[model samples]
Target: MQFFASLVRSVYAATILATTGYAPSFSGDTKHNAVGAAKAIESFHPESSFETFDVNGIDHPLSDRPEFSLEDAAVSFVQSRLNITSDAVAFRTGYANDVIQHAYIHQQINGITVANAVANVAFNKKNRVVSFGSSFVQPSSVPSNTPSISVTDAIAKAESQLAGEYNGHPTTLEFVAKEDGSVALAHVVQIQDDDQDMWVEAFVDAHTGDIVHLTDFGAHASASPVYRALPLREQNVTQGFRTIKNPQNKAASPIGWHNNGVTKTNNTSGNNVITYVRGKGGARYTTPQSSAPLIFNYMQDPTKNPNATRANVHAARVNAFYVVNTMHDIFYLYGFTERASNFQNTNFGKGGWGNDRVEVSVQDTRGKNNAFFYTPPDGQHGYMKVYLFNRSVPMRDGALENDLVVHETTHGITNRMTGGGTARCLQTLESKGLGEGWSDAVAEWTEWTNATITDWVFCPYLKRGGFRIYPYSTNSTTDPLKYSSLKTLTEEHRIGAVWGNILHNVYAALVSKHGFSATAKTDPKTKGGNTVFLHLLIDALALQPCNPTFPQARAAWIQADANRYGGANKCTLWKAFASRGLGIGAANRVDSKKVPAGC
Candidate 1:
């Protein structure tokens, strides 16, 4: 529950003009419509929350910077439209420092800024307004010579071109409708190489209505070709050991929780990077490929061979493989089942239980941010390191360790997909709880598919685990806040267990009709297509900038969901769940207030 609180608080924003119950005072000569729009936003506070969507199991955070104001948008739109000089009326919002942020767009003639612009000028409550802050550029070009083209039509063309190149690269674009009912292209950005790249920045030629000088940047280099064949050392298993112990157990548990072996460096065509060597005994050690000869398990003992058939060893390899293959670009995994400090202290810095996965940094072997930990042992986050603990061995007649592997791997996949960020906040309580609930759902689904549990549902691992996140029963549907009081729970472990059960129910219902292979069309006209629901959840969580409450979380989810699945998507899931037994009302508990009126 405390963990849930951390998740919400860190992932999860005000108003004014309407406070007097009067329209904002403005110079009679200025455009009042823009002012009205800004006041409406200020009154409702549009940039308060965020959400996300997913593709498959990938995450994509939708950030809503509360700093945006109607004044900002107006100033920007005006600056670009009027081709105003560097110094204008000092268009700044009064509350710029409090809740508003200054947005700017620079006019680049070649590569440098020829002129900078400010946007969203409005008096704050104090009337001082943004006297000083970050500067934003307004469009300064008056494109009267260029032939006018509809922004919507241009965007459609761009989108069609981009479809062939997305290749898992996340992207974004800003579109505004023109007076002629055509779309105007503002800016296009794409997330590439773990950074944001601007593809285009322009203003519609006011006179000609044609696109002026649109630029594209930050396209990703094609992914390096994957070498599907095993490395040269696979056949050699001489580095086997009878039993292993952590020699550094009395000391720090070797950097990352997932660090399994020494850091190995290699170079083929002048390109080189450090790689991990997972040892047979589980104890981690450091080594460099350029300096030391590569050590294989078979090198240690000719008689003893590392057995991939063994559940523990197989699970370790699978985990290792996932780290190298899937998330290799992001992190350097060390031990499969690494441990840090025993408890939550400065020395340990909130490390998870011994069985959790540990992602360490290759650059700093002993730095604070070096190792990122994940726990829960059952959901998408839990699967991050489950293979290290269970080792995929069969304890019963019909048991397989792949369940745990898939479960933990799901977490890794989710984090990588979403870039592991947080979501926005909300006024409602249900959103925060659902955030946890979604993760639990991942765990429950993974477990059911990977492990051969009799019931194949959540909370089956505990005694009296009859579908309660604690004493609260989410199954009852009467209380959507079932897991909200996890902080006050007498016993917290049951919180995750219970939530997992509820999520399991959701998954079962979804799969029963859609089939496990069902895909989300992503086109609004289609039904039951959002194949990326799991990815959407993770992406939403990753985008959360601060801790999130259930209500806030619901808002973020709605935003992300609609952004990814469109407006009517809420019903797609609701109807599916109702048919599965969860009922439509409970399934549709997500918050819709934070989103715009229609979308």
Candidate 2:
């Protein structure tokens, strides 16, 4: 059976000679197992638009009777329905959020696994199999497990096909199921180049010492999103970049980053955003058109004076790409559905128009110590420009600052969802201030950690203190801002501060009562004060009228709670709003810190 991605092979002008060693050969005369398992599954489920799979027969409950484990059930299912023998064993198990569990079972050849012969089975929290896929090989003849070439020689042979320094990850030996239903024992090697581009996994046939299959990791991007940057809470300690695979909410980005169902981009392009650096005065930088981990370990030398050359441009683009896609995935859980006209190149027929993916300009040059987002209506591209901050000795990138990326991204979210994807609702003076406030509030929410509740500042790395006039704090003397504070404030960011801080107060109160959940950022099913606050935050955007004032937005929050949680959070919402001087009778820039009669 066919498995994995399209294999890329290098052809030299001169005929390549194999390292002469032992000559273990496959008994080509032996007849391999044959079945229509993949076709059978396709016949069973005709309507499901399945992803790329060797054999995917899924999206339905496999058995009505619950099983203890998905492995046993999947193996049995393969044997009975897919016409596979009982030589399959569980390879790995992954469980997600106390809700879904996945099983990876590979076909075995004389107790050795066929690495390419993979089958996946998944179950919901109920322990019933929900999805099943397979790459079990039906070879014409099975090869001998004994290898003619040694593992060391196999490694050298596989390395000859690619250009890159070996990334110090592991190398192993396993059975490779070749095309046309044939099997070969091969040594698999993983390597990447100096620039951290061209991540490759090559499979060498152990019998003939020929490079059997090759996979460019950049070609077939993985099914999840990963990012590396200083987290929102981190300071200027300069730990360098870390490889973090940020969680992709299933409902939001089904294919992870760098994909739009039919095609995959090896660079920073994806369904939600296309990330790149203009490089100004130099060549643009991003991952090349090859499967490679977007890893950047560039370090500046203290011996030389700091300049633009010292900045890690690749890392900046990747960081911006990570934040943009992550924000898309997170807000999508809180009512920013495709029907709501979120940024996306393709909606997968879910709803809404297409061709509106966000375009990210990393390390932009238009401004200093700041970033901006320009959003048009639905079906048009949204632009985010993150500039460099010259405040530091080596200079800092706004893309490295998580809050700035988030604050800018929220502009797209609020603009699209505010007036039914019109992108014009928040153009008035009051609404513009509210937009800035919402952006900052969302940024503050994302930066919050479960360890402690402290005042949140906007883009703190740029300055010794904070970006805003005062940090968002619950203490009266520390912030001392009221709903009416916007009356005298002429600037939008300051006027927005009043709104952002009030929401911050509300967020703190809910966290005190229901506690915080770090997982709530991506997992909407998580139950916590932060989750409730965000649910209301995004839900209220749709509920409130365009150009709404403080009181109107507050009432929308109450109504959103009533709509989503059956009014379970009504009292808590009332108290949080009241403490922020947005009580029932408060209106026209009044700070009436009063709840209902009972409260």
Candidate 3:
């Protein structure tokens, strides 16, 4: 009865919108399918050179000849090959260089636009067409001008097709092309799960209520200790101390002794972060309001009694929040704005879409001995879950690990900034590995800034010294990740090692030239090598093209340096990249074993 009642309510709400008199329609008589489009492209010019690749089972023909205008070639090729109307495709986005001009075109049939059906056209420096690729649809026959069912009925049909508890809103009414080459008027509904963990856009046929298409937007995104510099204990804290006997050896493990000198409010909520106890029904737990600072018993098993583990975990949460907020603010100083895909709630309509919050889930997996970050699109909250380490050996809780927390938090930051605020852009093999590398670099930066530990290792407590393939050191023998190493490394983390090592060298070079200044950590204008490197790194992200390769990324850093210092650091930056086998003319083949020669 409740289910029916809820359905009735949803139907009523949806029906109310149909009363506004919005009806879907189609006007085009000619349709272009992939098969016809391919032929048309091949025959565009008999003298033009071309190549073909099978993308997602569709054979895409690309013209590499530089003899035609980009727009003219695209329009003429699609018109002659695909037979679509001239005005059907509209320009979406483009970027140009002396070597090539790339343009993205979107499809619009009648007046309504088709979602995700886009074509990419490229032109070379000679003003001639070079390449063309697209997933654009070619409809057989335009759908009827009118739909038999109302908008309310379409929404109900879409909801009916969903298996789990869901909430959705009708986003658009447009004609969508099916895989079978048929076109139909459909309702685009954005469906999100109750937990807000996953979301998808479903295209349901307005006339028959058949589900046509769906796009997934789900994005998925760490430590332990014995006594030495684990989690929040990376730095000594004199203000807040709570002593508890170690659970394994009954040795006293003092918690909450590592504070970064900045005082945080005892209230669970803050301007940018909110800390919650494990499994507290997502309720915010109150921090103890005392001058002596917050403390927890270290001997109690976090899984058995989360309350006993709260003081330390909470401290870790506070430290993580501080580190993330600091990184956010530091980047903000260098131009990472709300519109630039930053992680912050309540943007006040500044530059980015609002409602970006980072949810720090401490002790999330009980005794799972792992940690990870899950990033969603802008405006949606990002989730960081830190589990208690209990795999082969019962190690310290992950939340207490400073470098690990910073590492995981950087994942959220990088994912948001890259790909223009969507995690989808960094899905390439190299890009994905680079994301991990960026995280490690940032974690190392944070540790270096804090002057917490001398050894440049991650998760030192859990791994006795470090867990990475090599400690992030300047010594070439210790950190031997070359560009050629990517060929044998299929795992994301291992691939990341190559990138991380490269960045570590860059940091070392900068520090060696300009010298490290402790005050530069908070001040962007301090001119210290580390500060300059940080600023350059943040600026490079903004300058980086979508799904960038390592060479492109190297260029971005150089450009960032040029933009800030008028290319004063070009020689140093080039040396850093060249030393890592990412020098100019380095092949962008991650699957190749031959290493490029350094400059």
Q: Which candidate is the best by lDDT?
A: 2
Candidate order by decreasing TM-score: 2, 3, 1
- Determine which window of 10 residues in candidate 2 has minimal summed lDDT: 38-47
lDDT tens digits, residue span 555-594, model 1: 4444665766574455544443333233323323332212
Tens digit per residue, CA lDDT, model 3, 369-395: 677888898888777787766542444
Q: What's the lDDT for all of these models?
A: 0.29, 0.68, 0.59
Minimum summed lDDT over a 10-residue window in model 3 is located at 37-46
lDDT of 1: 0.29
**Cα error, candidate 3, residue 538 (Å):** 0.8
> Model 2: residues >4 Å from true position, as ranges?
1-227, 232-240, 260-262, 279-285, 289-307
TM-score of each: 0.31, 0.63, 0.52
lDDT score of residue 174 within candidate 2: 79
